[model samples]
Target: MATQREKDAADYLQKHQIMELFDNLTSMLFFYRPDNPREFLVEQLKQLKLSKQTGVNQQNLFNNSNLDAVIRILDPANQSYITYAQYKHALTTLGIKDINESPEGVHEDKISHETFKSEAIEGLQRCSSTYIKSDV
Candidate 1:
């Protein structure tokens, strides 16, 4: 049950083509050891810069021939755990012609929600025209 503000944020991210960017960042967090507070903090620092480095891809994801595969590639898009048919449905809806283009690029895609969230937040800031800035 997400709050209204949270839902709006998600919608904004999706509209800007940064959805996949956030997803990639979220997936990477799994590699860290949650039990170690120090390691957790260190990873957070490293992640702050990642989203910016990824930036929004210059090419439109929907327009690209690889979109369908990308939908499947994103681990979270499968609801953080999804079935193959769900992946197939996305490809079908996106009208992706080739089924196997390798969506490695689309893996982790989201804003890495956090107030101190820097790089990703900054990356989204640069592309602010896509959302947060758009409201202004």
Candidate 2:
């Protein structure tokens, strides 16, 4: 629950509209065009206001089959050069004995074959460099 003070603060902020005011100020004049300056300015203001009021969800904004095919080609395999022993040794060396003691977590940052992650590739470089030395 929001505290009384928090509610009061939010109410005050709503009236002030600090973000809206800042947006207006920051976008006053970028360029003075040669042709129909006022019309261009009005259009620009309309676009800017609409964008600020309603932010775009860029991740789900695009849908292209060609792009998806390209991504599939570039995607990495879950299988790596790291031997099981190398993985075990690195974990042991890093004092991570309790790892895999429990069932593998569904929401873990670790990689699965089905759902690949860019972060996992970076982690493989950082935390398990020794294990990934061999090209298996």
lDDT for each residue of candidate 2 in 1-136, tens digit (9 for 90 to 100): 9999999898765555544333333333332333765776566545545544554211111124532332344334424233333333433443333434222233343323222223223332233222122111
Count of backbone clashes for each model? 10, 0
Worst 10 residues of 1 by lDDT: 111-120
Q: Write the per-residue lDDT of candidate 1 for residues 61-135, one digit (tens) a residue.
A: 232234334444644454433334444454445433344323332244321212112222233334322322222
RMSD of each candidate relative to the true structure: 14.8, 17.4
Best by lDDT: 1
Candidate no. 1 TM-score? 0.23
Any idea what lDDT model 2 has?
A: 0.37
- TM of each candidate vs. truth: 0.23, 0.21
lDDT of candidate 2 at residue 51, scale 0 to 100: 46
